[model samples]
Target: MIPLAMLAQFRALHHHLLRLIDGLDDAEYRRQYHPDLSPAGWHLGHCLWVENHWLRAVVLGDDRTTRHDARYYQPQYSPKPERGARLPPRDAQLATVAAGFEANILLLADQDQRLDPTHPLMTDHYLPLFLLQHHSQHLETLRMVMTQRALSRHRHAFHPQARLRATPVAHETVSLEAGDYPIGGAAPKAFDNELAAGNARLEDDTIALRPVSNAEYLGFIESGGYDNPALWDALGRAWLDDHPVEAPDHWRRDGRGWWYGIGLEGPHELEPRAAVHGINLHEARAFARWAGAHLPHEFSWETLARQGRLSLAGQAWEWCDNAFFPYAGFKPFPYLEYSTPWFDGTHYTLRGASRYTPAHTRRPSFRNFHTADKRHIFAGLRLAF
Candidate 1:
């Protein structure tokens, strides 16, 4: 039987997701703010689809299909760019989602089917946990979408006198002794890519105690870090050739200095102590090179995190140097598409949690991946020597 705690958590997560898009109108809800992100409405429907597909359909052995339009809701069927246009009117979509949410609650409360010992997903209530984490992840993405919307709508009301200089913050290092350290996660809630906990050897290296702040990154920018080809890798250089970015995403300049735009309340003066975010792998690598350091390997990062040395947790997602590859005994769980397809060497692993990342997904072994050139994610870097 599903635990009462799991059921309560499910309701809380569902409500949180709904609250994210509460003030958005039909246009805002259906509008695709970024090329990489699905519309807010699409996220709502897709979350329902995933919950239904796994719980009511898979666990309960119900053959009945979801009433919502599959083409718009199923990611495999509708591409990211096309999802916005395909979304139903705002009220219609919410009505469908509300019905689905009720059904999901009932499915979670049902003790008879959950008691089936033969189902691996139902074992230890993994399915409910997975669904909750999955829902939490999409809530993060919805936040990204909303951030993009706010940025797109912002009109720069520049005030030259108001331009504030970023305060200089020093980077401090913590040295770890060379040894084999336990990495990956064996917990039931761990992602498939983080499964079958293993050990990895680490060379004696000094890693930054905290993520690089905006002030340090600003020095890199002013030094023409982007113009220096030697600082970037081959793919990074190529990406730069196509899309030359002068600064981090959401940063704009007036006649006097730089300002950072956050979700509706920004274009505020940049905070020096704050971790630099909205940077992709390329930018992170470039900054590391400029600082005469390197991005930490995923193993090294996990080692530091497990030892409780990573000081700035939940500030920004830290980019790791290594490609996102599977652990030695890796096997896909629940679905093949989740982690299997992303194993291509192009994707890099990001460690730690962003401010928007949910508590359930904040474990050290939880792996987040993205391609080199994508900067829409709230990511930053730390230097390793």
Candidate 2:
């Protein structure tokens, strides 16, 4: 049965998402802020599409709503760069999402108590939870895209005096004894990629209690970390060929100090103690090399997290040392597009969540994977070994 509280939460989340795009103009809503991001309109429609399809179409066999253009909604059919062109007008997209939400709410009234034992929604008991999580993931993406748009629209215009500053704090590394530690797939709501929870035999190692900070990364910048070929791997160097090797996304220099921006917050002076926000795996790896440390493996991260030794939750996603791949006896979920398509060894696994990450979806087992060169996400690194 769908609990009343759960239903209320669902309504609240929908409202929150609506407010996120409440003031976006037509151009801003439809703008593809980056090659990696879809337009805001596309995400709004896609979120509704999944809820409508899974709840009404798949579960109730009641796909009365007209289907969206497959070319715009399907990831494989539409690449990221071309999605803006495929998206409908901003107002039409908003109306479509609103309609889907209303339909989904009505469907929720027929609680699972009436569902047959073998029904798809019943068999996959977490479908509602999954839908909520799916929306949360896309909401994070939308938030990032929106943040990028904000930064681009108001670069260096923010006043330094009006901006707030974060006080510097010292961080410590904690030691864990050698043992077999379990990682991923432990949580009931874990995604398919985190399934087949496996044990990792870890040697005695030390890991940072918190994520690496902007001040720490600045040392890497000053030391010619980008120019030093020894610190960067071949792929990292290759990635730098086309992109600026120095400075992370959202960061800029003004004479002697640095400033960074995110979302609608405008820009602020670089916070020495705050976790660095926008470094990709390659960049994280290079920074680790410069510090004479290494990125923690997923297991090590989980071990620290399980022990409650880890800090800085819901701040920055931490990069793992391992490449993204399926575990032994892995099985794809009903949604085939989630993980199986990305197991081509091109993406590295990242663990944990950022400040903008939704509270309900923050799970230690949640494995986030992206290409090595992608840096727009709120990703940072923690030192291991």
Candidate 3:
């Protein structure tokens, strides 16, 4: 059980989500994206179900509230039906979700912080925060899905969906004995996911740690950086070809003008020093290669994470070259079905949570991923040498 205050916050959160989905109608809910992501309708329902399942069935007594579809909710299988087969209509979906919400919140009321303790849902201290982050992530996904559904005219409406998305991640910087120092967070550990190797020197030395800023990447753009194939990997080059990406997805410069983007700040002139967000690992890798730099290993991020430096964790995801895989000694704990199927080396790892990531989901130990080819969500990169 989470604190009562947080439970209230969660309740309010659900309301906000409902508001975010305000105008979409029944026909719009069942629409699907390629086979990987869920349809907006089922996605929203399942999002509600996940929390309900944990609190109602798994956490509190097996308070089986609404029937949860094991086939659809199982996180193990990829390429599953978009949130499962079509539904009984949008009204039914909303009512079912509403019923689940009422029961789930009661279970969380005045609850123990360590509600279930051993449950993967309970052990994570940051679960609530991750849940908040995750909700925003899906909200963005839904927004994009709707926009791509030929509703480009409605794009203006989606910008505000991510407004309250800043989450706090702890960071710090510490030096290591240089020379190929061991990198990466606890193997399969999640990004919250760098460092330079100078060769063994004094331990506990200090170093500078910062999220990659927009100005740094803007310089890459101003210099015709993407034109050089040397800066791109084969896949990155292919992606560039297929997409014809001039710069960041929402970026534009008019008449030697200052940079601008569609972000929480609305359409403000781009700040170069702000972390260069919304780029996927592939783009980050290409950018680093072009600049003769390297993406820091988990070691650097963990060091920086320890330093409590930049406000990462909840603001946006930090790209790392690592792929999401279990540790050598990984044992299936609370959610075997969730992480195992993704282990076939199909996705790239990212450290830290973006404002859109669920608060329950963001943790230094939490590793999130997508294919290197993806750049749709709010992801950014931190450079290292």
Determine the backbone clash count of candidate 1: 0
Which residue runs of candidate 1 sit more than 4 Å off their true CA positions?
111-118, 158-169, 264-266
Model-by-model lDDT, in order? 0.83, 0.77, 0.58
Best by TM-score: 1
Measured against the true structure, the TM-scores of the candidates, in listed sequence, are 0.94, 0.92, 0.71
Residue-level lDDT for 169 in candidate 1? 37
Q: Candidate 1 lDDT, tens digit per residue, 1-385?
A: 7778888888888888887777799989989999999999989989998887777667666637654465666777788887778788898888888888877787678845543655888777788778889998999999889889878887765453444344443567888899989999865788899987888888998999989888788888878899999999998999999999988887777655546546544456667778889899999999888888899998888889998998887799999999999988999886898999999999999999998898889988889999998888988988887
- Say which prediction, candidate 1 or candidate 3, comes out ahead on TM-score: 1
* Worst-scoring 10-residue span by lDDT in model 1: 160-169
lDDT of 3 at 226: 77
TM-score of 1: 0.94
Q: What lDDT score goes with residue 73 in model 3?
A: 56
Using lDDT, rank the candidates from best to worst. 1, 2, 3
Which residue pairs come into collision in candidate 1? none
| Full candidate order by TM-score, most accurate first | 1, 2, 3
Off by over 4 Å in 3: 33-36, 55-68, 73-85, 110-151, 154-208, 252-259, 263-269, 310-314
